[model samples]
Target: MSTTTAVDPTKTSSLRSGRRFGDAIFSALSHSAGIVILLVLIGVTFFLFWGAKDALVADGSEVRGGAGLIAYIGPLIFGTLLSSIIALLIAVPLSIGIALFISHYAPRRLASGLGYVVDLLAAVPSIIFGLWGMQIAGSAVPSFEFLNEYLGFIPLFSGTVTTTGRTMLMIGIVLAIMILPIMTAVNREVFLQTPRLHEEASLALGATRWEMIRQTVIPFGKSGVVSGAMLGLGRALGETMAVAIILSASGGGYSWELLSANTPGTIAGDIALNFPESFGVERSTLFVSGLALFVVTFLVNMFARWIISRRSEFSGAN
Candidate 1:
């Protein structure tokens, strides 16, 4: 009976109050972080909008809408999309393959080393890639002229080659290299997250390694792969230095024909190249181009989020 006395109700109440207080503090911190993020987003939108106001207005130009803005934005948007699309095409498959190798096939030691190499690649700076593209890739273009020549018939690659290497193809290749790390890392993580139970069950069902991965691993990780690729696409769309150094015709519209050497100018590249020298209306035009980029990137990210959300809902329902 002496040992049966419960702990003091007052002490228990105090402990509960303390936990509640700690939880409130943590909740406040999380809310503050979210508020800060919202503020930053708003600030960027306001700054860019304010900066580009003049360009959004109709000038005396034939185009009724913001001609200057359109003119400035025309090439940049195409270039950004073009380069990103190219990078995605190359990076996504390779990343999936590498991810599969690491997750299902490779020994632990080998997988770790390969993963480390991929992580190291992600750490490599854009400037370094740009420099390498300029120095080495540029020089090697001639050796690979067959690719250019074969594809040159396409309006996009019609540009004549010079001693200096800057071509759409070259820029695309450079972008592919730049985005590889992002896609690979994402793929690896998503694949690695495949539950041991699911994998073992798949194998026990007489499934081949590839069959297990295709049915179980990929299904589980598809959304993550898409997320990763979207992130890489964002990076590619905004890439400046490497594109600036690698693209030959970073100022004009798309080459309608394939294999055109003319480098389509991306919005980010144009801003980087011309913003410093621009003034008055010209500067405002650059801002307008930036606004366009902001819109497109925003839309792309929103679309990706929507897709992911829908997929998540579907998965949850199942």
Candidate 2:
């Protein structure tokens, strides 16, 4: 038995309008930020291509091995892909293993500590990794000599091992280590995010812990693993300082021999080594090489995305 308080329709309308206005403002800001990022990427790509045009049109210069745009970039492409592939091959499995141990097998406190250590590795500068690769890791691995000795029959391994062991294989190994922390960090987070309910259900069905992970965790995290691997590959592809420091590319071109003293040609390394001395057409050619690398990386990323999207359909991740 109390008097009814009448709600003002105008007040409710104003409140609803205010919320809608706020949401609209937030959404617009987010969309604008994304657009700005996209525009910046496009602008950079355009600049690279524009800078490379002079080199592309010029006749083959004897200085650049009488190689036109295609020839100029071809070996660098091969080197970049080869080194990155090797790094991924070595890093991915180890990263996944480390991630699994941290996510599932380790004590919570220990896992947290280990994760911090792994993250700390990523904070180390690329220059430091390059220095270590040049000074320490290069000499520490005698496996290069061993491989050259025993596996020399294989074309891939057939090469003279340098005193410094600064071979493509060594670069790949160092790149693998450089990328390990990043791959591990991403994979661990993804694995940790695997649905607890699914894991519990698998275990409740009398599955062993390993079996539970195999059935529940791996399936859930497969896409995430691929994503992390691709991220590492991107890093390896663009790595400059380490490759430049560790690689002894002296022949003015790329080499495929993993154990060769000839350092694998990479765009970033090439730019670092030659840009200072480059002039006019030579400088333009360097820009051309950068454009090529940009295209290659872009394509690789697109391919990875396509693969992930296709797999997602079957994996029920969609």
Report the alpha-carbon TM-score of model 2 versus the true structure.
0.90
Candidates' lDDT values, in order?
A: 0.77, 0.85
> For this target, which candidate reaches the highest TM-score against the unseen true structure?
2
Off by over 4 Å in 2: 1-19, 252-254
TM-score of 1: 0.86
lDDT of 1 by residue, 1-318 (tens): 889777776555544644477889999999999999999999999999888776666473622123455564676687788778877888889889988898778999999999999999998989889888888765765754665577666645555654455665567778888988878898999888888888899999999988999878998898899899888888988888987766666455655432345556777777787789877667877777788888999999999888888768544225
Which digits, one per residue and each the tens of the lDDT, describe model 2 over residues 1-318?
245566667665543644477889999999999999999999999999888888878888633546567777777888889889989999999999999999999999999999999999988888788888888756655887788789889987886777777777878888999999999999999999998999999999999999999999989998899999989999999999999888877653556678766755788898898999988888889998899889899999999988888866667454
Tell me the lDDT of candidate 2: 0.85
Note the residue pairs that clash in candidate 2: none
Query: Positional deviation of 185 in candidate 2, in angstroms?
Result: 0.5
Positional deviation of residue 113's Cα in model 1 after best superposition, in angstroms: 1.2
